[model samples]
Target: MLESLYIENFAIINQIQIDFHSGMTVLTGETGAGKSIIIDAIGQLLGQRTQPNFVKENRDYAYIEGVFTSNEKINTLLDEMHIPSDTQLIVSKKITKDGKSSIKINYRSTTQMLLKTVMSNLVDIHSQFETHQLFKQSYHLQVLDDYCGKKLSILKEKYFNNFNQYKKLEKEYKQLKNEELSDEQYDFYLSQKNEIDELHLDDFDEEEFIKERNELNNFEKNAKHISQYKNIMDSSKGMMSLFKDGLNELASIDSSKIQDLHDQLYDAYYSIEGINDDIYDYLQLSNFSEERYNEVQDTYFKLNKLKRKYGASIENILDFRAELDKKIQYFENRESVISTLESKLKTNQENAFKIALDISKLRQENALILENEVKEILKDLYLPQVDFKFQFEKTNLTENGMDSVCIVVSTNVGQVAKPLQKIASGGELSRIMLAIKTACQHNENNTIIFDEADTGVSGKVAESIGKIMKEISKNQQVICITHLAQVACFANHHLQISKQLKSNDTNVKITILSDEDSIIELAKMISGKEITEQSIAHAKQLKKNNV
Candidate 1:
């Protein structure tokens, strides 16, 4: 449920913070007192698109924030998103004049799409426009499924998975049956297979081959450098020979210091001699032949050619080769492969059909319960004569399980049942929407906001609508905006929205009404700008009767 909301520089609302509570709350004011503006701000928090004009006239940006108490479902969702779970969730949105916007959940930056997904589980906002959704045939099926709840959801998921598998097998079978390789095509595929098989690519290392080829190309230059270094170190007059002569001369000295110098020089001379021996070993092993180089070049060219014809890399080429083997096998054993796929497709289709039938059976059973519930709720909404039924048609297997359900209704006695969109008046539609909402209420702690959904009806019907909302509030939170005193009188909490002029700018102000103030507001709603004694008495009576 929405615990509170803060709006700043949003349209005419410069700055305002409104705290909300559980149960049915009503917002009432004259037209254009920013009632719709408040709803729009809430919409922004729900991830609706924002416009530049939503910002205050001279302000650079607009901001809206909503705080909601967390439920198990909300916490589970937060866990999935890797956000820290808390007792309260703070959702905020900021929109700049350049049409840029940013959204945050618990002060962590998030995308608008993700915000919409999370907020959908937390709040449901229905406006007058949403009431018209009943007229859409697609929406009828969803409503029926929602009413059916978890049993039908589980069945639908099963059918969806099975149907997708069936379709995949069916598609594969058709493709295999349609592909008839000609004699020339078969020969071509065989030739390609033989070419790939001859390469013996399983043990090939292209990178190592390239490295060896580069070494061969520069072998002469490397050999010349090695030869020069060996001559400088191993010649009779070279550093190794001179060092040995110096060591001999030092050894001939009779002094103790001379003997230590001779020992040091002797160790250094042997180290240089070891390096010379290593260079000679390398010269013996570093033989390069023109024939080996030519052979490598030919192999490289062939590999490049195969890459250009089949794939961009060796791994991709190998994958393509595997696919070629499949095609070749299919050509050779066409009848056997087709027979196997046909059998698998048949089995899959039968299984999918069984699940779809189970789904359709459950839907038919639940439809009757939903119809009865809608009828009972309509009676309370003052549409007692209205007849409600579900019209079901068998459809080809689909993700929703081969059921096409439409809502048929008769608004008056003796009237033939017709599609709801054709026969229902605007007032009847509103009442029917309310009935559906009440009948389909689930056991989730989500806030429901009705933005003047009570329009186009008044008197007892309006009062009944308010009573229904109040009953819904027993399970979850409900907030409504209305002009009728009949509906506003039932609110457990009342907020009065009015425009105030400050510094030559019009801003929205919300006042949480006390019991007496609520009555005064109701009286004003009933008597149009003047609260007469009779209207005050009527407001007081209305509140008393609802209690």
Candidate 2:
């Protein structure tokens, strides 16, 4: 049960703290007196998103905290999250002006995900807008599962685990099938692979061949240049012969003066003679045959073609060849693998279907019990001839199972039951929700907040709704925001919210009323801005008679 709520610097109501009790508690106020703001603050504590406007006009942050009596389920969660808690669990939310927020439980920092897990077991706030959830068919599964309790949940987890495995394998099988090559395509790939394998080009040095080809292509020009060079350095008519003859003449005149000059010329003659001999050898051994050139040219052209088609380098070509080998192997042995996958898929589908059938059986059994209980509750809520049916239809297997559950109802007797969304009026929807709430009983020890759940209900029906809430509070705690005198009069604790302008700022104040004060408040609710002596008397008797 929720023990207290303390809100500071929140919208229009600065620093308001409200204490709660174990039974039915009602908050009554005039329109625009910040009653909904209090609910919104509780919502923020429950892990709902808060807007920036929730902060007061001049405040930089909004803080909301609540104290709750921890139950076994909640304490177990806190232990799993390593959060320390005593008998009482204090949860707080702090939101800054920049929209950053933090949550703390028992003075230990916690995350929003953890807070939601812990608080969900403590509070179940049902606002007016949540009634639309009744119209959605998908929500029915959750409702049924909640009714079925732990037995259905264990089976549901097992079914989904198997279903996921089945889907994964099915996807893999389809991918492999799409990747399988046809006969003609396989043959084409085989031919390409054989062509590359037969080449034996891995050991051939293309760089050395390219250098040799260049030298041979310029052989004639090179031979001509070497012959001219030999002529210029020859012994008979070359520059070296002239230098030798001049050296001999200079030596015959002044041997000492010409000795250094003759020595230098001798060295020059020997150097030129050695280079001429090497040139003659090269000319004698040069090979420039057309057949060899043609062979080299053909091989170079073929290698370039392979480079463009396969890859720019030998390593790349080798890698592509390896990939082709894998593809070929797959094509050769695909039939056996496909057969295995198909057999596995069949087994998986059977298992999933079997589990779905089991789940459906359970739901069908629970549906009967649910139908009877809903009809019984609605009868007391002023729907005497309401025909309530739990309709089930088979659908393809989803994460939720293979059955679709819908609530069908008829407001009058002898009328065929149709979909609730199609036939139920607004008032009927409200009562139907209340009846489900009463039947499911999912609110054990939970602080259930009903924001005007008594709308579209009046008189005896309103009184019945109030009585139901009061009874529910015996096991759980209920906080109701209502305008109905019938509902508010049954409050174990009645708090009035009134707005006042203090220091030029709107102030929302909550006052816990006395017995006499509650009668006056009820009278105002009954007469609406014109409370009379008779209205007060009626309010007094209304409270008395209900007691």
Candidate 3:
């Protein structure tokens, strides 16, 4: 359960701290008293999307934090995430005017998605808008699936996988069948295939070919430089000839110092000669020729043209060539491949159908139970004559399954049941939605918030709605924002929200009303600003009866 909430600079609420208790707690005040603002603040704590306008008029940012008593499931999740688990959990959110937001769980910075994951089952808030979703037939299937929970989810996973495989094989089969080529098309593909096969692309290296082509393009300039270098090093009047003549003259000296100098010159002369020999061998191996250069240029042009027509790279070209081979092969042996795909598609369809039938069976069984429970709850909410049922239709395999569900209802006796969107009035819809909510309540300890869920209800119907909420609170926490005095009398705790002007700025304030104060507030709700003796007595009697 939520222990307390602290909000700062959120909407018109400059700053406020409100404590929540387990049981039915109702927030009541005059219109525009900021009751919905408080709900929005709690939504932020639950990781709902925030808007820039959420920040106060001149405030830089909006902040909201909630302290909750940890449950076993939450603690287990925290352990998995390597976060320390304690009895109390602190969740906070901050939104700035610049459209930036941050969330933290126990002061540890986390992402909005993680916050939502942690808080998803901990609190369930149903606003008036969510009640309208019942009109959508799609939502009806979702509701039934949610009621089935993990049993249906696992079956759905298997069906979805099988269905996807079937679709893939079906698409491949269609494409292959459509690829029947005429004689002219077959000839064109065969020629293209032969041309690519002659290239031996498996051993082709485009990078190495380009490198060799660049070297050949600069051959004339390099050849001229090589000729000049050979003349300077190996010509008769060049460095090598001059050094040899000097070494020969030095060898004739007989003095000891001259012998030492001659030995050093001998070593240096041979080192230079070895380097010259290596250069001569390299020049001989080059063998640059005009024929070879022209051959490389022709290959380069052919490769570029292939790239333009088939692909932009060697890998893509090879892929295109492989596809051409398949097309040619299929034209010659089309029946065999088509037969194989049909067999696989039939097997896949059977497997998917089996799982979908199992899912539908489970849904049919659970639908009966859910329908009975909804009718029972509706009877308590003063719709005793209501008839409700699930209408299921077989559909093509979709991600969800092959079942299409619609909820139909008839609120009056002797009336034929029709689709909910067609037959149900606003007040009747509210009661039906409440019945569904009660029937579909999960076993988890969730804090359920009703933001004017009793909007189109009043009189004894409103009182019954209050009673149902109070009964629900016996297991889970229930917070309601209501304007009806009949509902307010049943709250275990009553909070009065009122707007006050401070420093020429509107601010929202909340007060935990005492027993006497609650009675006065109920009287105001009953009489609408002119609380009379009769209204006060009526409020007292209503409170006494509920107690």
Candidate 4:
């Protein structure tokens, strides 16, 4: 509940603090005496945005603050924001001349959006303008959903899970049927992976392999050049025999130096023998076929193409092939899974519809009960001949089910109760709103603030509205701004807004009225410029009767 509201440089309230406790608190004054200024200050602390116009002539800013007793949900949230509650929470708002707004909760700086979200749970102020929420179809559905409590909460969770599950399956099924791979692209990928896989080609260096092949292809020409060059050294027909004879002649010298030279010549002859055998093998092996050359050239091109398609490396190409294979396999499996989920989803949708229908059926019955309650309250508001009814029609199947709501009203009997918007007088709208607030005020967790709810109402009608506010105050704190003496008489606490001239300026101030003061104010409100002994007596009786 709101503990107190503090305002500075807010409209006519230069500086004011109104301490409030639980129950009916009434603010009354002559028109334009700043009753709304106080309420607007509280609204600002509830995260209403403001401009520099609200600031005083000499001040650079307007400050509004409210203190609220903590509840469990708000406490948990404050702890999350690291705000210290210390039993009472102080939410303060500051607006600078530049229209910049800042907020603080429990003295720790905060955001307006966060403040508004948290404060909503703590107060449900129902001014006359907002009391027709239940008369709107969507608000009626929300009310039923909230009233259904855990049953509706559980169903909502179940429905969402089912919705996501169905959407996932549907998405994959669509992708599966529309899996796009043109024939040309498929052929390209197939050929690339196939070429690399066939290459039983183990670790071979490309540069070295090309060089070796080139040398082998020129082996015959190289052999002829080496032979012709060796002919210059020997100048004989049998070159090998000539070379051996020259070695034998050298060996015939018997000195130690000659012996060394002869052994070196023998080793040279053996090396030549090995070289001769190697050359013969090369001559035979170097015979290359056009088909073999073409095969090597084709394979090199194929391997290079595979490298370019997948990546710049053979290893990355292999990895890409494996990943694509896995994706294809997953998509194939998803196809079957979606078929299974589709059947399950169809069944769940049917069941969900039935559950929603059952909830709507209950609301249909409850609507009748609610209509009678409204009629009873309206009759007390001196609308005995008025027609009011809760009309329920079928609507689309929504998350909360299918019940359209209409609040129908007629000013007199047999005049036909048209939809509320068409027939309700401004006074009747205010009274009808009061009736609804009184009916549901006991259930919601918000405070009700009435801004001149009793305006234009008089006599018995004014008394009934006052009594209704009193009854609502039994369970909820109701702050009403009023001019009616009958309305002021029923307050658990009375605050009177009065104006004074000071320092060449007009100022408005609010005071909490004592029992005697309340009766006097009530008398003043009833008789206007005159306070009569009879008016006081009537005010006293009205107060006593309200008690």
* TM-score versus the correct structure, for each prediction: 0.80, 0.71, 0.71, 0.67
Which stretches of candidate 2 lie above 4 Å from their native place?
181-333
Positional deviation of residue 237's Cα in model 3 after best superposition, in angstroms = 23
- How do the residues 233-347 of candidate 4 rate in per-residue lDDT, one tens digit apiece? 4356567778889888887887998888889889989898777767556645766565766676676777678778776866676677765553445444655655665676677
TM-score (C-alpha, index-matched) for candidate 2: 0.71
As for lDDT, the candidate ahead, 2 or 4, is 2
Greater-TM-score candidate between 3 and 4: 3
lDDT per residue (tens digit) for residues 1-547 in model 2: 8899999989998888899998889999898998889999998888888688888888999999999988787888888889886889999999898788989999899888887878777888776687889889877777777888889989999999988988887986787688959999899889878867766666767688889888876886788787787778664978778877887887786666578877887787788778778879986776777689788777777777777989997677777787677568768988876788789988887899899999999998998898899899888898989988778999998888899998889998888899888999988998888888878776577888999888888999999898888888888899999989998888888999999898899888999998899999999999989999999999998889764
Provide the clash count, candidate 3. Answer: 0
Best by TM-score: 1
Clashes of each: 0, 0, 0, 2
Score candidate 4 by lDDT. Answer: 0.74
Q: For residues 368-401, what per-residue lDDT tens digits would candidate 3 score against the true structure?
A: 9999999999988989999999999999887777
Question: Candidate 1 local accuracy as lDDT?
Answer: 0.89
Better of 3 and 4 by lDDT: 3
Q: Model 1, range 162-185, lDDT digits (tens) per residue? A: 899989878867776788889998
lDDT over C-alpha atoms for residue 512 of model 3: 96
